[model samples]
Target: MYPTEESDPFCLSAASATRLLTDAPWRRFASMGDSLAAGTGDPSPGYANLGWPDRLAGTLRRVRPDLAYLNAAKIGATTAKTLANQVGPVLEFGPDLIHISCGANDIWRPDPDLAEIGWNLRRIFERAAETGAQLTTFTLGSAFVVPGFPDWHDRVRALNDITRELAATHAAVLVDMWSHPVNSRPNLLSADRVHFSTSGQAVMASELVKGLVDVLRAHPVTSDRAPE
Candidate 1:
């Protein structure tokens, strides 16, 4: 059994039921947000960047052989642009499962606006929820790990707090990246010291899949709509 709210108020429980993915009613998966979702650091020689979302999709494919996946994320995307550009395409895809990761870029900018970031994120979450998809997002790990961004640590924390609040308000799955063991490991980061390395991506995908499975088990879908 998963930990109760009393035991895990942060909702950082690790999922043990791998079979839940097979049983969940997720046929179409869509991803939005920024470069992290775009799979920037984990590059392949021939194929496109296989980021954590792509890795998660591959795992989902194992359970549902016919799953359709679409990633509309781009490198260097801000929360505002993501809210504007990615929402329409995601809604068009009509995915039953969606992942969104953004705002890190905005937080690093000079004179970062926490209120504006929160507003844009709320809009994105609200719009995504309208599609009736099970949405998932994460709190950024400590920005102290990122070289040359020591001053932005507080901003990252603020954004993470907004993300956590929005996740609860919107009933979306939240991955507590701040508490994850990989958060402190420097090797998990790519040369840029911002994005995750291939191994780091794998670790993130592993943890994220667990969260997704937990959400599915708690709120099993009962629809029969096919992927469009």
Candidate 2:
């Protein structure tokens, strides 16, 4: 009854969602990093089977029927692993738009090295940015908690800070989901209570579309010119 309702958060129809990104110029979209980027989660009652990336691609395809899409995200992938693994394939894909997600797995350990994580992430962003693609990413929601880790909040905050700094430095379109009102919803996460449910995935995709729409408003991308 919640997500199925049009009044619920992120319950946008395909046409309504695509309308917001009518000016989007990206022909090829690729996503890389961790399970969050992979869109792993339990099936939510009122949501589609699609993950955020697929859902996003669907909307993009509506505007550009020839849009090419790739998702190279893996479960349990840390920042270092993402750098070592996914980046090459993503580069090879030669995407015009790239969505990156990581850092959560890096901080899953009891003693995470924030400095190292930042360095790896910076490298990841540098490589992605150098490709001249429109980069997009989102911060983890506050509801994703690791129970045994007493300092979970502190860790997430620190990681979010790093993500924010990188996003600013690279001028990446960012969806700042940290402390978002959606996190308050009881059904936001899956049974694992870690990854987002389909409802959350839908919300993530819609939010990302909105983020791109905002960027297009501030700096419209011309047909001849790539996204700035």
Candidate with the greatest lDDT versus the true structure: 2
By TM-score, the best candidate is 2
- How high is the lDDT of residue 193 in model 2? 84
Spell out the clash pairs found in candidate 1: none
- Badly placed stretches (over 4 Å) of model 2 are 222-228
lDDT of 2: 0.89
- lDDT by residue (88-164, candidate 2, tens digit) is 99999999899999999989998999999999999999999999998999998898778899999999999999999
lDDT of 2 at 184: 85
What is the C-alpha lDDT profile of model 1 across 1-228, one tens digit per residue? Answer: 322222432222124323446566778999899987776674422222456777677767766778999999988899999998998999899898888889988987868888899999999999999888888888887623545666667777798899999889878888877767666554556667677665556556767777777776676766464654
Error of 2 at 95 (Å): 0.5
TM-scores of the models, in the order given: 0.82, 0.94
